[model samples]
Each structure stands twice: as C-alpha cells, then as structure tokens.
Target: MKHAPDFLSQEHDPRDPNPWLAMYLDRSTPIDDEVKRAWLADSSSRSRQVILPFVRPFARTLIVLFQVLKFVTPRKLAFSRTLHRLLAWGMQNFIRPEANWLILRHFHVGSQVLAFIGANSPAPVETSPLTPQRIGDVRDDLFLVHDLNLYNFVIRLNRALHAAGRELEHVAEPDFSMIAQPGLRLEDMPDGRFNFLDLQSSIELFTPIYQLLLTDDDFWRATNSLQLDETIGLYAATILDARSHLVLLNNRHPLVPMSTLRAGFRLTLHGLSTEMLHKVLFDRRAAQEAAQAALFAAGG
Candidate 1:
C-alpha cells in the first residue's frame, strides 16, 4: 500500500474534521519557526519594521495611484508593461537573501501540497505543470496564478466525482447548476484574457504594507491558514460556470473579500521572495534532476 506523505501522516485533528482540509491547513514544518525567527531578526527585516509606519502611507498611496493608472491608461500605450518591469527590477535589486529563501520555500511547500493531494485524492486532480519559466513568467502574479490553478483543479475534481455518481465524504459539493444550463459552454471566453498586470501591480504594491501592518505571529498565522481554501474552491466553480455578467454581479459570500485580501497579502509576499531567490539559486538542470528524484520517491 502507498504510504501517506510524512506531513499528512499525522493523526487528523478534530478542529479540522476533513482530512484533505486538514492536510491543506497544516502548512508548517518543524523548522518553520526557526527560519521565521531568523527572517525576523535579519537586519533588513528589523529596519523595515522600524520604518514601516513611515512607509505604510506611501505604499497605500502608490497602490491607489497604480489602480487609477490601470483604469485610465489605454492598452495601446502598453504603459503597464513598463511599470511591471520597473517594479520587477526594484524587487530583484532589493530584499535580503534570507527573506528571499523563506518566500521561495513557501511556494515550494505549496507545490508539494498540491502534489500530495494529486497523489492521494480519490478524485482526479490536475495541477498546473511546474516549470521554472512558468514560475518566472508569472512574476508578481505568482500567488494569483497558483491560486487559480488550485481552484480550477478542485473544480475539475468535483465535476469528475459528480459525473461518476460518487462524492468525497465530508467535502462540500460545489454547485454546478450554472454550468449545466443550456446556452452556456465552458470554452466560451466572453471577456478577453484576464489583466494579469493589474494583479501583479496590486500585489507588488500591497504586500510590503501588509508585512508591516501584521505582527510577526499574525503574518505567520495567515501564511499557514487555510480558512479560505474551500471558499476559493467554491468560487472557482461558480466563476467557471457563470456567464461574464452574472459573475460580475454575483453576490459574494461574507468571507470572499477577506479571503481575497489574505491571499494577496500572503501569496504576494512569498511569491516575490521566491522570484528573488530564483535569480541566484535556480539551476535548470539541477531542478530537473531533483524533480525526477521526487517523482521516483513518490512512486510516480
């Protein structure tokens, strides 16, 4: 029999009744506290904390300015791309290496979580193909990208189970009525491609302010929390099934807004850090080798 991964082997906690949900919720490792302490104690982290009050207003103002520019600037001007490159360059040059590692490791952990789910879940789960280039391409949109991928994966999984007249016990059944209605097709893209640069800018602008606004424990707790995971799964199903106008006018659950905020703050902070670490540590051949080893170990 295939053994559960080390992280998932722990006895299920009553607080999180569902094993799958429990798996998603338990994101910390034994070393996380040690690494977090080191990250917090680093000179750059300490300095940022001291100056955060002064920086918070400036950051918030820039976020508003960017949101305005995103709306006003014509796509023909391609101004957003220029801003994207500039912000990318700034992040590349700044941010301490220690902090960068913690950030990159966070995504690495997320990827592993997805892999474990795919390996063990009763329903088929397909995640985005992991590649260094794809990771690099997303840049500041990494958090959003990872999230959308997971959301889509869960939607797909739920659909598969429903089709077979089976369901995962204790998991919420996502409503698929919108997709079943006549005249709607899953392939239709009524709106053009999503404006990823808008997402990138929003994340790039807000994460630093959030880092300062939240206490260390609060920040870490949010990072580890999966409070919104199921909500995101349901929303993904809804968005995929609904027409563009309905999606726009849809009534959001009370948790949806907070979920979005938490996702942006948590994922962006780690995604940017991962990008910074990639600049110095990424080796394509070595990454491929390591991936192979992981697959072999997992009995893939």
Candidate 2:
C-alpha cells in the first residue's frame, strides 16, 4: 500500500486543517501505516522539537510517581473510587478549558468515524459508545498529565492554523456552564444515575480536552508506539478490549475496582484510535476479491 504524504510537507486543505483527520478519513492506505507516518511526521515537526524538551522531565517524574502510587494504593473498589473522584475533582478545577475541549473533541470525532463505518460496512460494527458522563468521569492522573503536555502543542497548532487562514471544521464549541454547576460533587454521583441530561452537560465540559489531545503529535506517537516491542496493534487492542469488558462487567455487577474503571476509560480512547484504523483498513470486499483471485489462480 502507498504511504500517506508527509503531514508537515503536504499542503493542508483550509477546510481540514488537522492532518490527523485526513489520515483517519483516508481509505487508500492502511490506517496503521497512516498513523505510523503521522507519528513520524509529528515527531520530526518543529512543534514537537520545541515542546518535548520542556515536557520530558515532567513526564518522567510523573511516570515514577505513578509507579509508586500503584504500589501503595489498595486495589479495593471503594478506596480506588474515592481516589479517582478526588483526581477528577482536581482535574475539573485545574486543567485549562481549552485543554478540556481538545480532549472531548477527539471522542466526538471518534463517534463520527464509527457512524461513518457503520453506514458503509456490510456487517454491523460493535462500538462502546462515548458519552459525556463517560468522558467527565475520567480519573487517570497519568492521562491528564500527558494531556497537559499535549495541550501546549495543540494551542500552538491552532494558532498556526488560524494564521494560515485554515481552521478545523466540524468541531463544535464546548459550553462549560452545563457541567460546572454550583456545589457539583463528581465523587458523590452514583453509578447508573447519570441520564441524558448529565451526558449533555458532561460533553459540554470535556470536549476541549479531546480537541487538544487529538491535535498533538506526541499523543499519536505515544499511542502508536505503546507495546512497540510486541505485535503492533493486536496487543493494544486486546488490552483495551479487556479493560472495556471489565467496565461492562462492572456496569452489570458493580464489583470491579475503580482502577479498572479508570483504566477502562483511558483504554476507550486508545480503542477508538484502534477501531478507526481497523474500520478503514479492513475492506471486506477487497479481501473477498483477493481471495477469489487467489482461488482462481490455484484452480488453473
């Protein structure tokens, strides 16, 4: 398969300023290859060069802290849930609004891609739908810290895109008021209590974070290179699927620890990226055609 043109070198469409969207939407190249190429381009970009040095030390420190936290924290459901709630509260108060929008927008785009695949595919594709409550419930400090670093890159990219008279289309402006109610207690909210209204409000609050992460190169490169020593997509997909399944089971049984739920939420984002690649790369008709051609040659 032909590789996608280098994102940095290629002239971007004004209507689609984000090259990752173009990569996600492209059907000609395998999605994994497109992602890999995007990662390479992003890593070498001037933006990454400037930002990584400043972010690396903080990231390394956080990694060590995360390891220590895991070792000390009890693996109990109630205890973990309380910790996650505290973390969520911290994130809600501290993280920038722009960062929140970027994060939420990534899921919005993922939902759009899933819709597109469903419309085109002959078989129904199973998806763990992303909603506002699910997004706002995020509790992973590690994910948030990495996202903070990514936000620096996104704001710069958005500024550059704006200067070039190009803008990312299809992203809706997020409203913060919906979920930032007075006396709001994220920890107190019970499981299965969030309704459609809660979902709407959460979406308003979290969309910006999704947008920021989606625009950053390090986010893409990190996800692609996760478990790099193993079979590329398979291990990541399996781990994501397992985490998601645990979340599903928790929904039914309410037994699993909050660490599992937190891992599940982070994995959902990774899973969406994987799903986008799989949907784009696995063309059933093309596979069928290739199989038929091979069969005909073998018969002769």
Clashes of each: 0, 17
Residue-by-residue lDDT tens digits, candidate 2, 92-138: 55432323333443444343334333322223223333434433555
Question: What 10-residue stretch in candidate 2 is worst by lDDT?
Answer: 173-182
Candidate 2, lDDT over the whole model: 0.36
TM-score of every prediction relative to native: 0.45, 0.30
lDDT of 1 at 127: 60
Off by over 4 Å in 2: 1-55, 68-80, 133-300
Instruction: List the RMSD of every prediction in angstroms.
Output: 17.0, 19.7
* lDDT agreement of model 1 with the native: 0.39
